[model samples]
Target: MITGVYSMTLCDIGNTSFHFLENEHQFKVSVEDTIEHLNLKEPIYYISVNKDGEKKLLRKFPNAINIEDKIVLKSNYATTLGVDRALGCYGYSDAIIVDFGSAITVDIIAHNNHLGGFILPGVEKLKEIYPNISQKLTFDYIEKINLHTIPTTTNEAISYAINAMIVEPIKINYQRYNLPLIITGEHGKKFLNYFNNVFYEPNLIFKNMKLLLEMEK
Candidate 1:
């Protein structure tokens, strides 16, 4: 059997998952299991938010560039911002990017200014937190139900609360900034109803990666 060399393989390494993309094929797995199954002997490109995970990925695939290193932000902040946030806002003059991953982040860039954003636990983490606060508040009974404005049952209440807690801040910031909204990450697409003019681009990181590669060449 001939082993095919994958081109433009992009990995967005995050705290909770490693999203691997090759052309149109996409795979997501936990960080611990990624190295074993990933076909990365050849050159690849990646972006990592977890420092330790990045180190491990580098040890496994030395040829790959940490795409974050190639990025040059046009704006400044008091504290350091995350590279993933930078990439999401890259190439956009004015926009809001809501990344719904392990941690939900609402990154804002308006008029080429990196205004920073809000961060909160993702819906899964939020659900985990509820059970810790009270065992009776467990989400074991909850299914992936569409959020309702006025929830009637316990499960509905928890579901709505979880979704609202994540989306409300993004909605508020979008209204406040009045800029274009670009949603990405795991749960990014499910937020379409929250905004009037929002776009779901799951490939924002990969698009940024490709741009970086083109700049290098």
Candidate 2:
């Protein structure tokens, strides 16, 4: 339902990076970079889960607006839920939203009402676990995982375990809810092989941001 040209810039600030959408072009800036050096001319409407980054960005961009309050959606989630997770549920009446970032967040929305969901360690974090247990256990994740075949080697075992850890819970939830599965974030597309009725939207947050901005008008 949102129509017309969107000339404004939108940002989603996280702990490690600043994700930006300008005239449909998306890019990221590292948190270590100086914000003022970017010399952005336009006003940026943003949402932030990173408190320190939010403060720094606000000081650098006087015209920047935080649109967190403008994102009003039906939910029964606790007050402590991350803004990113809440926004993922936007425009979805019944679905499971899985965001694969530094941490994977799974949120459920049923009949336009957000039910509470769970979080799991992401691929990077899961990779870290084996190394901590033993030096020999350290191994990179495989590109392709065959769930049906039993793992024979150490690498295969680790790979299968990692995939199962991430995928099984989602499968259980999908079976319980029987709703469309929505996947987003950095590793969203990689998960498409595991589910049948799954959708991958890398710019989900940005899409929701645009919709929220339109509602503000």
Candidate 3:
């Protein structure tokens, strides 16, 4: 639509880090590098950022798009909309999405591709509560979420709490809805032990982002 070739620079900044993808190229930069680059732009630009990093990145890129402060207008209905669209395109319906990143989000997509249910708090969130609870306890949790009845120490107790807080609710919802579960995040492996019908797709978010970006233009 332009006179010259214009590449899209999409920076998906999460609670943990920034994922910089430039058009079709894989321009991966760390959090520090990204911050420095943002500051270099004279006129600055609108940058999509997380609620946590909004203030910081904005201070750097004064004119950057603060999507964190403003809600994005979406073709799909909800935050889970991107995943729903992609999964539907791939002919995947009746599935549960367990995204375990900063937040463990358990979202259920109905057979008709509508969002049917939801839950939260994956492994990381549980581990956050551990160190404060006891000396031996640290931010350690399984990469998976499953059944472990015998949680001996405070660390184990936190895991158990996370399981009960996150996984068990999903279990209940899955039981209620009767859809298969699909997990994606830093801690997908831990889920392998507990669930039989679980598929781990690490780039669910990336794929969704790509889809949403496409729809934007």
Candidate 4:
């Protein structure tokens, strides 16, 4: 177990940003920013999916500890599963964890075992696809969409398709597993409209990181 939980600094490096939790304070910095600029002075326990960012962090901050290998969980998922997704499902016995970051990952944990999951392009990434297809398809981001309604306008059509693509599959799995939905990551809250018995946990990964640290000892 951690000797001083309150003083522990945890960092989660993603493709787009570096998320830091120090004490009870949480903040983020862009991956493009210089690592030395943070002026961090504590021993940091971190997990990262961004190879470039991880390298820079380790090179710049000798105090930064890479704890990806320390996370011990029984998963039926292939060896290639992302650590973020694995940790997201760590403490849950039965749940569908949908993480919306640079990519959307849906992982299932049943009876404390990971049953594998699927991935899709995230909101921002999906938005870029239509414009590539045709400039006329370009539209402003829509925060809310009605999947039941047939879209009439170009913008509504794009929004409907995006929401349908992301939500429909998860809804199918939710019905199959009959598990509580756990939503997390940067864009996770935007999906609250589509499900019942759902939870929004922005700090799910960080919470599990602490659990993993304890288990490591």
The best candidate in terms of TM-score: 2
lDDT of 3 by residue, 53-159 (tens): 55666666556553222223222345544332233223345677777666666655565455544446555556676677777777466444335567676556666
Query: Candidate 4 — what's its lDDT?
Result: 0.87
Kindly report which residue pairs in candidate 4 clash with one another: none
Which digits, one per residue and each the tens of the lDDT, describe model 4 over residues 1-217?
Answer: 3365446789999989999988788999899988786766477899999998898888888778888777766898779998888788887889999999999999988898889899989988898899899889889767698888898888889999998999999999999999999999988888898988899998998999988877667
Angstrom error of the Cα, residue 45, model 1: value is: 1.7
Tell me which residue pairs clash in candidate 1: none
lDDT of 2 at 109: 91
lDDT tens readout by residue for model 2, 1-217: 5487647888899868899888877889887787777756376889998998888888889789988887777878778888888888888889999999888999999988998899998887888899899999977678578988999888989999998999999999999989999999998788889999788999999999888877777
lDDT tens readout by residue for model 1, 77-102: 65478888888887888998888887
**Per model, how many backbone clashes are there?**
0, 0, 12, 0
Per-residue error (Å), model 3, residue 160: 3.3
Q: What is the C-alpha lDDT of each candidate?
A: 0.78, 0.87, 0.55, 0.87
- Report the Cα lDDT for residue 63, model 3: 62
Give the TM-score (vs. native) of candidate 2.
0.95
Q: What TM-score does candidate 3 reach?
A: 0.60
What does the lDDT read for residue 213 in candidate 4?
78
Question: Model 1 misses residue 56 by how many Å?
Answer: 2.2
